[model samples]
Target chain A: MKLLQLAVAVLLVAVLGGSPLSAGARTWQIDPAHTNFYFTVDHIYSKVRGHFNTYSGAINFDPQRLGESSFSFKIATDSIDTNLAKRDKHLQSADFFDAGSFPEMTFASTKVVDAGQGRYDVHGTFTVKGVAYDLVLPLTFAGVKEHPAMKGKEVAGFNGTLVLDRLAYKIGDGKLYKLGVVGKDVEVLVTIEALADK
Target chain B: MKRTLLQIFFLGIGALVVAGGCALPFLYPTQTLWYKTGWEKAVLQTGHLFGVFAFLALVLQLLFGSRGALLERAFGVSLVMRLHRANGQILPLLVLCHMALVLLPEGLANLPLGLTFWPEMVGGAALLAIVVQVVAAQVRQRFSLDYRRWRSGHRWLGYTVLLLAAVHVLFVADSFASGLPRLALLLLVGMMALRLVYRMVSSRR
Candidate 1:
């Protein structure tokens, strides 16, 4: 009985002490050159798509303990590109992202829930035009592997989709709001490729 | 009688123009998702609206000289001519404003005034057509050209502007990809084509 009790106590101590330290979360920096953050919005009857040209982010991930992982991203509002120079300038102005006043739109994840099959529900605070909102971005892990170009380095890729309401951000208020010409919903698609630090 | 009709007609069109301009933004609230700022979208959209209005006015002037003149019976040829002159003078200013507002927002250096890509090429060609027409109209009298010859040249230039403008709008207009805007554009172009055909048949007769 004494031997059995000692074994049980040892197992309990090992389980409790090992679980937290075994998280093994690894940090990776976003490879901006390979990352794409694009969005689509309803315009009249069709959806118009565009991309942000500049962004940076970091991910702290643990495949085994996925719930403890975290992510943070920052995008330069002025880097908006829709293949139109004039349109981009207008977007950077006070009416849209207000790139002058709020140069960067950021997202920092608070909770992550692994939903099997390499999928995760990442809840974060997304700030744009100085307005912060709780947003849930559904992310899928593409994979992690040895990079061909970067010697002795590993890369991890993730894709996420989020739908946002423009009106919620007060993006097009006043007459434009009443006009209803611009669609209220904006869909964001994020492709992140990160390089693991040695 | 002619003066009263002319005044009333002008007053009615004036009201329509003012109301249309003010109500336009409210009617089409869905701006392109590509734009970051609402004001930017509004400015770009306003530029497009001005171009569309100018095109309509120019088309009306084109139809005025036809056999089945819509305004001649009601407003008299003199009043129609006056309206045509007004449109001719005002159109260049409208075109100037449209081009400036449309291109200047992108920054002067980045203006897509090139012949490489189709959209930019078509827009560039349209601007060129407008410039040619304006220059020709301004200098035609000084060149001592015969009235018939000058009128023929003027008609051809007008046709060029219409064709290029149509191409530019079809290619670049944001809401043109579907539904109402496309349908309206098709109807307007079709009517214009039918009038051109009728004018040709009558001239031959």
Candidate 2:
């Protein structure tokens, strides 16, 4: 009787660990209208700030089941906007993102670590210009509540920042970076507002 | 004394124009933001400054070439012609420096090209025009070129360079993309066009 009970318990644990939904994590789709993805980089004497205008993601999250939570995003590389059309074109050219050959940059979480007090460190693989690099984005849960405008809907917000080396991803000409025409470190600011799927 | 005063007044106006043109790039909002290291910033700004000075020199070359009655009276014809020759000789050197400095930061590999870089290509054409005009002027006697033909070609080529440089400046960067800088550039270029037209008509008459 003891052996049978132990086997049943082990099977139950494996099933719950393998399936995210069974573990109580809910699926949430990113609300594009309410989310923002911004980035900044040094350009000669002033910083250039820009954002990706088109992106979509899904989040499987549960405060009680942190281990089962995950996040995945797909951003259209050609949607980069820097206010200056010439610069934007340059960035999208072979010199930078090479958005022509690589139309999308993606991130999928491998792990998420809770740091207490509504903070989390998300480790993921970030791909840009067909180059992939491991990245850790530090995020803060900004709380969840009923949607103000949408009836019978819940919205959750997550904000995070990640510093990436442009050279690692080969985002720009390495020679330019060495000459300090553009700095290597790029700061990406992410604010995601997601809606729970019923 | 009257001639001296007029000379001084015109000289003052010339100095003011150069100063104002040089200041326009720095007045750009992006100028104040810290995006690059001190040395890189210095190199980039110096490159822009060189381009600005070159443009001013080109404009002044036109003014001196005009040999207008007012300029001749304010400064003798000999002095004006001498200034014109000296300015022309230095123009090529200024342009080379501007090109080198601007390319240093981004490197030669990233030298802008293609249809997307039309403004920069226009600037490149202007540089080529300068080279052609200078070389032709220097070799005219060797080639036994006709004086009238050479002068006419030189005049039209100078006008072309002026127009090309103006378009490059107006569209090349965000600094002059809008607002005060755009207005100032249009006014300056328009004034030059008017002056050139007036000179052409007056000469024909």
Candidate 3:
């Protein structure tokens, strides 16, 4: 009877301890003021650079419990700015992102693999224009420090680059892309700074 | 010898116009997409060149028909009339080529329509006006149309074509959308308008 009770106790402790809620994962809110999501693509012989003006995300991170760490982000598609209003309108039109139908793009991490040091390989599903694609983002955690202005609050920084296939996402007219009106691969550079929830 | 020198000078001006129009696309190229293949680049460039040529040809048609003192003295009234007729025939062909080449890479299925493509629609209107002007002129004698009435209609249609063409060129492409190219186009159109106005006022007098 005692042996059975001891087994039950051990199982309960193991189950509770392994739960993500109890894994010491810290929830961090993305700081829109400091975060940047810039993208670059080849436009003929030149490179066109643009960025999303509105995006928000959260990071659930615990260095000790890497398996429980995850990241999620949502970006407003209409907030894309390429410094040219005409191009931006085209990007938001049916020929491109179709922002009227798909107003937001989202990303959710499925797995996170530590690569030693401050680097991590985050495998996630990125949904754009109503299509989801598996993507792996190699990110560097730039350590954490107390907010200089906001005393007692902690801030963490992360940055990574992601290459997206525009055709796969149906972001633009395939025929135009084939004729080289726009590039196939779009490189996205992400820089995120988050404040740990109190 | 003086007449020959004047002819050479006019020919040099025509060459400069053609060269300048062709060079605008390259010099003020919009950083949109680097064409993937040589064939596409050539086709697209040729399409733009044709558009420029068509506009210039329309302007030349006006110049030939103007019966200006310099043109009358250099080429005689009969020769100027022949040049005007020949340019009218070629103008429609150049416009046709421009439409075909520009639409080739973009595909006919993706041809932009409605108010959103206002500049392209203006170009279409200009093309329609050119065709009507040319066809009417061709059939004028067969239809027993009075020369005075036909000439008045032709002059008005010419003005309309020039207005539409100027608007299309200014708004249709990125090259002439702004900067020095836009300023130059405005200056050329301004000169053409002044000449037309002068002709109208002088004829009335």
Residue B174 CA error for candidate 2 (Å)? Answer: 2.4
Instruction: Give the lowest summed-lDDT range of ten residues in model 3 chain A.
Output: A85-94
lDDT of each: 0.73, 0.82, 0.83
Candidate 2 CAPRI grade: incorrect
Error of 3 at A80 (Å): 12
Tens digits of per-residue lDDT for model 2, B1-205 = 9899989999899899888878865777333123334676688788888988998898888888877788899999999989988898899899889889876655454456777679888989999999898888879958888999899889889989999998988777567888987887788779879998898788899
lDDT (tens digit, per residue) of candidate 3 on B1-205: 8778777878898899889987877787643324324665677777888988898899899889777887777778999999999999999999999999876655454455667668889999999999999999989968888999999899889989999999988877878887888898888889889998898799899
After TM-score superposition, the amount by which residue B153's alpha carbon in candidate 1 deviates from its true location, in angstroms, is: 3.4
Residues A112-186, model 1: lDDT tens digits: 888889998888999988888998888999989999789889999999887888878867553443555567788
Model 2 chain A worst lDDT run, 10 consecutive residues: A85-94
Which tens-of-lDDT digit does each residue in A1-198 have in candidate 2?
999999999999898877755656688888998897899988777899999998888798888777788988999987889986556665766668777688899999998899889998888998887778888878899988998888888999999987888887888657667776788899999999999743
lDDT of 3 by residue, A48-132 (tens): 9999998888798877777888988999997889996557656776667777789899989998899878998889999998888
* Native contact share for candidate 2: 0.00
The 10-residue segment of model 3 chain B with minimum total lDDT is: B29-38
